[model samples]
Target: MSTVLTHVTDELQSIFDRARSVAVLTGAGISAESGVPTFRGGGDSEIWTWRGRPVTELSSAELIATDPQLVWEWFDYRRGMLTSVEPNAGHRALAEWERRFEDFTLVTQNIDDLHRAAGSLNVLELHGNIWRARCLRCASTFEARESPLEENPPRCLACNGPARPDVVLFGELLPDGVFERAEEAAARADLFFVIGTSAVVYPAAGLPITAKRRGARIIEVNPEMTDISFIADVTLLGKAGELLPQFLKERG
Candidate 1:
């Protein structure tokens, strides 16, 4: 049983050729291809729970304050899981695009460090990185990549204070400056890519519209139809790991 291949349109190819400043927004779907389960997706129920408590409950600011050890333990388990996952083809393709374009910005909702691992330099992480920890006292941050980290609720080197995962927890606001930069990139882009996202989560969901309002062509790459799919100049329906590489090849 063979499925018909979806070919990239000549119009899309032409848009790629003309694009100089490119901005991309990626979501959990991209990392899901690399075996990291999305928050709303299924597979390993264990990833979402610890001792019967939901990760959603364990990963909040309130939880961090009440039970920092439990929160750190859950994050440590997740970090261990991510240790074995590597950047997929989609990540590699974006990294390549950054090198090819005059100005490239990769904005992601994922906490996974896979984009940086894949060699992307200019990335704006909407949700902070899972591999980094922020000091509750000093507000300083440092990379904490060691899996099953030596310290649960790792302490800050600067102030002997408790730290939490740098990720934007449930109910927490997106870090200052990150979203502003993303909006700037969106406004400046000649081409905007909405990749692997459901296009429902705002402020991030609003970026595609911002780019479009600024006259950037919106190209959506996703397996499912998203909330913003209606605005896409072209929608390439598929997994990003496959479609992004194919898009690059077609443009070449």
Candidate 2:
């Protein structure tokens, strides 16, 4: 069962009141609430398999190069699964925060575009979006949202070369300059919200500590204790969808 949230204390309210600049980092946990299967799998922690191989193995630059068709097929199926998924309350709350704060940044580890769907304009996707594809030959990139794309391993619009999902694979580095932007935002924020992530994945995980070290207050929102929970200035334990809306309501 999800943990029940206690009362929103005066100290907690003060933290929100004192913040002028805010930055938020989100992960698969937030998207999972909207039915997106997480990288570590969802509620059951079952690894998604494709042709007897874990999907994680298939999600690599090497695999995409060796068998582009197989990679495309798997991603196409994944896209179809997310076609009807909608942004939930947690997503909307962040979007509202963006409008409320003059300097707000939303950095996410998810490839899902739910943050943008929820009307957050200042999102920096650390992982490239799943709905976008990159050209193999010319290295051009574009959005290709057609579920079960007309052509498996869809052709690049700029070049006839085959396309691959524009995501940061197991061994691939983050998209160019994305991490730097997130770092700058974290450093500049007066309040940093680490939501729905365990903060175990490095690089992305290190962002919270960066903000904390820079003298920003760190607020962690998750259902269970995480690796970085000890460092959080305020740790709100509950479902993000349930807690975030309540948080905004209390702040108002």
| Stretches of model 2 off by over 4 angstroms after superposition | 1-7, 250-252
Q: What does the lDDT come to for candidate 1?
A: 0.86
Q: For residues 1-252, write the lDDT of model 1, one tens digit per residue.
A: 112225566666777878899999999889988998766653353266678988789889888888888888888878888988999999999999999888989999999999999999988999999999999999999988888889878889899898889999887999999999999999999999998887688889999999999999888888876777788877788889988876577433
lDDT (C-alpha, whole model) for all candidates: 0.86, 0.85
lDDT of 2 at 216: 92
Model 1 spans with C-alpha error above 4 angstroms = 1-5, 41-48, 250-252
TM-score of each: 0.93, 0.93
* Pairs of residues at least 3 apart in sequence or in different chains that clash in candidate 2: none
After aligning candidate 1 to the native by TM-score, how far in Å is the CA of 71 from where it should be?
Answer: 0.7
